[model samples]
Target: MTVHDIRAALAADKATVGTWLQLPSPDVAELMARAGYDWVAVDMEHGSFGRTGLPDIFRAIECGGAAPFARLPVAAKTTVKAALEAGAQGLIFPMIETREQLNQAISWAVYPGHDDGRAPDEPLRENRGVGYCRANVFGKDFDAYMTRRAPELFLVAQIEHIRAVENLDAILSHPRLDAIMVGPYDLSGSMGLTAQFDHPDFKAAMERIHAACKRHKPLMGLHIVQPDPEELRRQIAAGSRFIAYGIDSVFLWRGAERPR
Candidate 1:
């Protein structure tokens, strides 16, 4: 079955929003999908997810008509390959701090031999070897699958640390970098504000990251907690193109708050 490309859907202004699945449960993922999200993210970075849990969560996400994305604990080639083989359609790499990190993230996500040293957005010089399974399984018919899935899978990088902010330009300018996401809490802590998004330090960092995204013209995103619609609208007006509304657990917790 051809999976819906969540990243492509969003790029087309198709209202693609996702909630994280902190636990590996197909039932929960199915319910969440029915509730109206376009994608489901499996949070391996902060959850109990391991190699054992990957396939289960990914399958659940797939069963829900929602694309599955893995937020890796770190941007390691082996880790990325593992999740992709498990059937994740996208990857969100955390704490990306340099251009080299972006390149590595792309290298890990894409097939090998694909790096013809050409510009990122440009056409490939050579069809890279299928060094991964997501490619092998779905992209087995390379030409057809590449036409459908190559641009569909997202290779996202998080901008949350002070060093990342300082290196934002070089990082964003890298051809392989697809999107830039903000980790407000981590970014606040990195800026010494420690969860204080209202602080000038935190605000400045966000602005810097936002401006960098605008300059680079890649997708810009944020994972906000209980985000006010107006505030979200303001950011969109200000330049953010991608936004994750909330976490899976938080959405569940809020729904449970209704008086019975």
Candidate 2:
């Protein structure tokens, strides 16, 4: 499906399950995409691969008919532009702690004239660069891509710090923010409580973040990193709309460790 489909599903508040890709291999990408995921996100923030491998991995994921998404290491125009041009249907910006950063992210993902999530009366803040690339079929469909694809690209913000949690409501208020994914590990680290998911302070921070979702419009997402189906279901039942199952490495390790 396309970004439009993902947006519609989020609007409908439906559970859209996806898995993470950290390996640089296109074969793994294709296999995961064909394994019943609605989408598959390439983990640039922590993955070993770089920009050079993105296109083939995206193509591989697309071969299995799943939307290819990406998690950016940092929000930079050059990288963002390249990722979108390489056919990323969606993007997740990590370490976002302020509304300003989010607005800049919107600018990077969207073109120069469209107000994807801006107020009707507000001025357009289009900041995406235009050029012939894979997304527009090397400019053959540039006009159509600019008019449609550029404006409809999915953009997600990852709240992974105490400051982001404190600013949650304001962060979620952005119209251009398609969804918010909680980076639990980083979040706990920011709170001086790394990996202590059960600590009161950590739980409190999570509670505040989740609470903000009930008061906002963007879809809420969380990662079920351990490959536990029951835990994945529990989060969805508790109100996660955009859910990421497990990273490719974990899945591979678990399968290999399973008794024959």
- TM-score of each model, paired residue for residue: 0.82, 0.94
For candidate 2, write residues 4-120 as lDDT tens digits: 777778778788999999999999999999998889999988998677788999999999878999998888887787689899999999999988778877788877667756655
True-structure RMSD, every candidate: 4.1, 2.0
Q: Candidate 2: minimum summed lDDT over ten consecutive residues — where? A: 117-126
Candidate lDDT (C-alpha), each? 0.70, 0.86
Best by lDDT: 2
- Candidate 1 Cα misplacement greater than 4 A, ranges: 1-15, 115-151, 257-260
Relative to the true structure, candidate 1 reaches a TM of 0.82
Cα miss at 21, model 2 (Å)? 0.5
